[model samples]
Target: MSFLEFSSDAFIAAFFLYCFGFLFYMIAIGGKKWSNRDPEQHVKRWGRVAYIVSTLGLVAHLAFFFTRWIGAGHIPTSNMYEFMTFLGMSIMIAFTVIYSIYRSPLLGMFALPLTIIIVAYASVFPQEVQPLIPALNSIWLKIHVTTAALGEAFFAVGFAAGLMYLLRVVDFKGKTKEARRAQRWVEFTLYVIIVVISFIITVFVFRGMGYEAEFKQMQVNIDSRGQETTTEENVQYTMPPIFKPYNSETISMDSFIGMKQPLLETPYWMDGVNAGRKLNTVVWSIIAGSLLYGLLRLVFRKPLGAVIHPAMEGIDPEDLDEISYRAIAIGFPIFTLGALIFAMIWANIAWSRFWGWDPKEVWALITWLYYSAYLHLRLSRGWQGHRSAWLAVIGFVIVMFTLIGVNLIIAGLHSYAGV
Candidate 1:
């Protein structure tokens, strides 16, 4: 087999290993109550087994990474698929580091799922290695992207830890205003996770069904001399189009559920021709997510919080809070170096300016600032437990929007990654 083919095999292997690791971790933690064996021994044995399996998954993942890099003749961090897989790997690294320090089975329970979700999400994008653009050829690309992803991975662990803390501590039975508010927010957060999973499921389902829709949209391009040129491009959809491109006509569309045409045209004010497609995806994901959430609600017949809160009964809220804080604190400096410092160096080299106010750049700054505030409040202001946990949770949201949402919602200099 070609190296790329072998790399793909390794990637698939890693994915399954991570899934198996997650299963083992669930057994390690959640199965403790029902298992006939002694709880402490069972947890220790199973958790160790889970950790080794996950580490093997990470080793397979590393093999995939280096083999792909060798086959592609560059670092595999250029596109969405590459960067996200790298991020997932980095999360596993962070998880391994934390596990070594804490040896907490509960951390693996949360962190493994987070890694699995991300790796699955990364797989949704096209996997073929493409030639780098001129702006991406610099050494800083590898340095900045890898480091930034690593930092973000730690933040993701912090998010998992924080969310777990919320699940453990938030009182579902209390009648007070604070309790009700916390319960609602926690449920909403869980609902959002379901939504992400729903979107992933929806994409794969439609892809498996060979769904296709196409539209022609007028696009504008700017050259290095700042000259504008116009061209028409064919935009393909893997999912059904609830909305069509702005000022564009259908090239062809495969009907689904007797819907042969788009329900609406995108507003002209959205600027980019791809905006309509992005908006359509967002709407579909929300719809699919809601349906999935409804089904889960029907099955559970209780708030998702109430269902999960029981499983977290033995886990310590204080430990979760500390894990969240440490992960973010460790990540903040690394993020500053990669997302801010190295990025500015790259920007200056690529665009002849240190800061261009690009959407991605602005969001990166916002993320950095938010995390900085988080650390400041955590250390100086003595914010702990619920408040600190919430900040870590929110900070990850900002970090994700900076990483994924910007590429999805708005296209700027970083638009190539969306391809």
Candidate 2:
């Protein structure tokens, strides 16, 4: 088999392994009711298992990606599919590193499922190898794409942690009520997670399975009167004209082939021959993402907050606030350097413009500004805890728009990501 084929199998295996690991985590989280008496004991035992499964899952995930990188002769940041894959790996790496330092399994409770969703989303895109675009063929693609992906990954974890923190603080009168609130919080998080995953999947699957979209253009074709036809018309296109879904084992080339005349006039998703694979890949990813998300919710009956210790013990809530702030302090700058500065430099080199108000570019700026505002409020306005956490949550939203939302929703110059 070719390297891409082997790598494909590896990734499929990794996906299933991640699903298995997530199942174990669900078992650990759901089993909390029986362990209330000896919380630490249960935490230690199951937490160890979660850490191990997560670690192995990460290893398998990285191996699949690295094999692709080796086959492609560069880092896997050449397209939207590759970039999402990189982001997924980066999130897991950040979680593992921070987890080791803090010895906090709570982070995993929030981070691991997010990572799985991202990786699964990546699977929906075409994984086949393709040469880089003239504009994208540069060292900057590696620097810009990797930095942006890593920055988003950090913010993604931060977002989950912030949400969990808020849910934990939703005051309740008694242990019983608090426990019920905990379940509600977990359910809400699961719902949000699944929705995001589902949306991506729906977009891809709907588009890939083929949708009827009318393109308004002037075409020069034979007229009904037998003369030359040069008038603007709305053309509707469909796919899988003859082949059924069961026999449709491969991407449809002729469906969207020979469609582009002026290169820039074409939609980004239909940019090239491999574009079909890319689109199909993304759609499938969304489908898988949604399923895995639902599975996560079903398995983990307990709320994620049920698994976390107070951000600290025997200490004031104020200290927990400070620690979270300190983390953002260290992280925000790295995020700025990676998501904004490096991206600008790379975009300038590739696109030949330092700044264009393109959707992706605009979203990146929004992400940067959102975090900047967060830091400013915390330092200058004396904001802390809930306030800062809320900003952290918003910051990731902007980051998500810049990362996934930009490529999928807004049309722009950087829409090379196979939808």
lDDT of 1 by residue, 1-419 (tens): 98899999999999999999999998998888998979889999999899999999999999999999999999999999999999999999999887787788888888998898899999999998999999999999999998999999999999999999999999999999999999999988988888888888889999999999999998777999999998998888888999899878899999999999999998888877678888888888899999988998999999889987888988888999999998988888888999999999999999999999999999999999998888888999999999998998898989889889888778789878877
lDDT of each: 0.91, 0.64
Q: What would the per-residue lDDT of candidate 2 be over residues 225-284, giving only the tens digit for each residue? A: 889955544433243222112111222233334542212222333533233333443444
- The TM-score leader among the candidates is 1
Evaluated against the true structure, the overall lDDT of model 1 is: 0.91
Which numbered prediction scores highest in lDDT against the true structure?
1
Between which residue pairs do clashes occur in model 2?
Answer: 124-281, 124-282, 124-285, 125-281, 125-282, 201-286, 204-283
Q: Identify the runs in model 1 with alpha carbons over 4 angstroms from their true place.
A: 218-231
User: What value does the lDDT take at residue 332 in candidate 1?
Assistant: 83
